[model samples]
Each structure stands twice: as C-alpha cells, then as structure tokens.
Target: MEMSNMPLGGHWVLVIIMIILATWVIYRYLAPQNAKEWRNAGLIQGFIIALYAEMYGFPLTIYLLTGFFGLEIPWLHMRGHLWSTLLGLGDVGAMIEMIIGLGLVILGLLLLARGWSQVYKAQKENRLVTDGLYTYVRHPQYTGIFLILFGQLVHWPTILTLLLFPVIVVAYIYLARQEESAMRKAFGQKYVEYMKRTRMFFPEIKNWKLLFKKG
Candidate 1:
C-alpha cells in the first residue's frame, strides 16, 4: 500500500504544505549569519521550491520525457514516482529505496544540525569549531547538503534536478573556498594547520578515530 504509485495528477495543496514545512525548518535551524550566508540560503530555497513545485504541481521532466522523447508508458503522467516508473522497479523495490533515502536525509540533517550547533557556540566564544563533525570534514554543513540532495535524487531522478545538482555542487565548492579565505584571515596559521589536517568536504577515514574521540 505504501509503495503503490501515487495518485494520478498533481496536488497543489500537498506541494504548498511541503513548502511551508520546509520554510519553517530553514527558519528554525538554518538561520543565516551574514549577507553571504543569507544569499546562500536564498539560493538553496530557490532550488528547493523549484524542486517541490515540479514534484507535485507539475511533472515537467515526465512531460518532457513523454512529449519530446516519445515515452509511451501508459499512465506515466499519473504516477508521480518517476524513478520507480522509469526503472520498472515495482512498488516494493521503490519502497525500499524510499526508506534508504529517508534514512540518508535524516543522517544528513543530523550532521547539519550538529555542525550548526557547534559553530554557533564557537562563534559566541570566538573559538574555532574543530571538534564534532568538523574534526573530519572542514565543511560538514556542505557535505550534509550534498547528502540530502543525493538522497532526493535517489528517489526522484528528474532531468531538471540532475542538471541543477552539479551546478549547485560547484556553487557550494566556490562558497566553501570563499569561507576558507575568511577563516585564514581570522585564524591565520592555526587555520592553515587545520586545513592541512582536514579535507574540504569528504571525511578522511584515517581521522575516524579522531572524530569518534572528539564526538
């Protein structure tokens, strides 16, 4: 029952509800720290809005697939689970993937929340956040965002999202570099030494012991 193809057609009300829920989450957990932070937040919000809008209000990718690419699957427009439909994964397989995706989203959000908590406290104390998730990845928040997007892609796999995903990743990489420059100015040699130990995004398995100890 949970894996049955979604009801045929879009649901504007559901889309609006999801957007409102997302807005509240961003407001409560991801409040921006400065002009640059606010701009980054806006960029993500814009991407999410476009994502969900098409997710429930309009199936643009499915439309393009059927309209231009000559997809002839009957009721393709009705079932909104595009990934399952496209891959011929029955409802059960799709449900399993959905569960994994949800777990990934939860893990990603936890990392983001924990990183934010540590950073907020560190900012107040004028101390660097090198413990917790930062012990491995210099940018746990960005890593978290990437994980979240990846989970979404696992379930959705829309062409529009696939195209935007790389662009968003590049943007975040550029933003992370800009952030590192400021950190260098603020912490000087200390920050440089930290960089030598930590990577920008992915965690070093070699530092797993350090992260476990610090965490």
Candidate 2:
C-alpha cells in the first residue's frame, strides 16, 4: 500500500474538539459528587484523551502494527478503523461498525442522563431510587459508562484504551460496592430488599420492556 498519498496525522484540532465534547457530556450527565467519583471520572477523562489522541492526532497503533508486526495497512484516516481493516471488510465494514458504535454511545448517554435525573430527584427527597432505570440495574449510570466506553472501543480500538477499559470497569465496580454499603446504612432493610430484587449491573430479561417505557 502506498503511504505517500494518504496522510495519517496532524488532526490535533479534531482530537481536541472530540475530547472536550466527550468529557463535557460525561461530566455534565454523570457529575461526580465526591472524591471517589471524581477519581473514577479522571480515569474516564484519560481514556477519552488517549483514545482521541491516537484516533486523530496520531496513528501510533497503525505505525506499531506496520513497523513492529510488518503489516501492510494503508495510512488513510479510514484505515484507523482497525477491526474492519484487520477483518478485511474494507469501507463498508467500517461504516457498519461506526453506526453500531454510535448507536451504543447514544444509548449510554440516554441511560446516564435518565439515571442522573432520577437519582438527583430522589436525593432531594431523601429517598432510595428504585424506579425507572434503577428498577432494572442497581447502578445504571455505571452501566451507561460501560456502554459508552465499549462503544468507543468498537468504533476505534487503541492499545491504551483497551488497557484502561477493564481498569475503569473494576474501579466503577469498587465504587458501586462502596455506594451500596452507604445505601445499606442509609436505607436499612429497604435497600437490602431492592438489592435482592435487582441485579447490580445487568437487567433481567423479563423486565426488558420496562426499560423503554417512561418512569
């Protein structure tokens, strides 16, 4: 593949814009309330920056693959869709992956937003939030984060992001456990009952329809 005609780098502006936009949406919807939440948020911030930095600002993964592994990937921006490229699916596969990835991102954002709204209102009333998304998952906002990050992974896979993904998941899982401990203290047996009924992250199959319905 000829590399001279297809440029691969110098897209820092797009990189900056994407990072800022993604971080803003994340902070806005899933606003961190304390030190722990903020720490987890920082991990996500780093993930976004590293993901976009490689995606637009540089093609480190492509370079590493071509130079170190001796692969012959073209240096086109579209070639950044590594999964499709590796799978030999070409442009059409990239488009399909992008559409699916974007769909997951949108769904994650909706879940984050709705979860935030409900939790905020419940906090004001000093009540437990076990309705709406909370009816399904004990930690819907975290699930949203999972979805968004997974979506980004599908859209554009990078070494750094791949490494950070599981770390972020583990961090959120720990955070969720800490949160549950507090909720258990605050709500006593009521929260215990809720926990018994609702799964921590994944929703039950029978209650799937309730996810689409308004709370």
Query: For model 1, what is the alpha-carbon lDDT of residue 202?
Result: 85
TM per candidate comes to 0.85, 0.93
- Report the lDDT of model 2 for residue 108: 85
* TM-score top scorer: 2
- Over 35-137, each residue of candidate 2 has an lDDT whose tens digit, in order, gives 9999999999999999899888888888898899998777887766888989999888989999989888878888888998998899899888888899889
- Which whole-number lDDT from 0 to 100 does residue 82 have in model 2? 86
The per-model lDDT (C-alpha) reads 0.74, 0.88
Q: Write the per-residue lDDT of candidate 1 for residues 116-142, one digit (tens) a residue.
A: 788889989989888788878899888
After TM-score superposition, what is the CA distance of residue 189 in candidate 2 from its true location, in Å? 0.5
Off by over 4 Å in 1: 1-6, 72-79, 206-215
lDDT for 192 in candidate 1 is: 98
Superposition-based RMSD of candidate 2 using all C-alpha atoms, in angstroms: 2.7
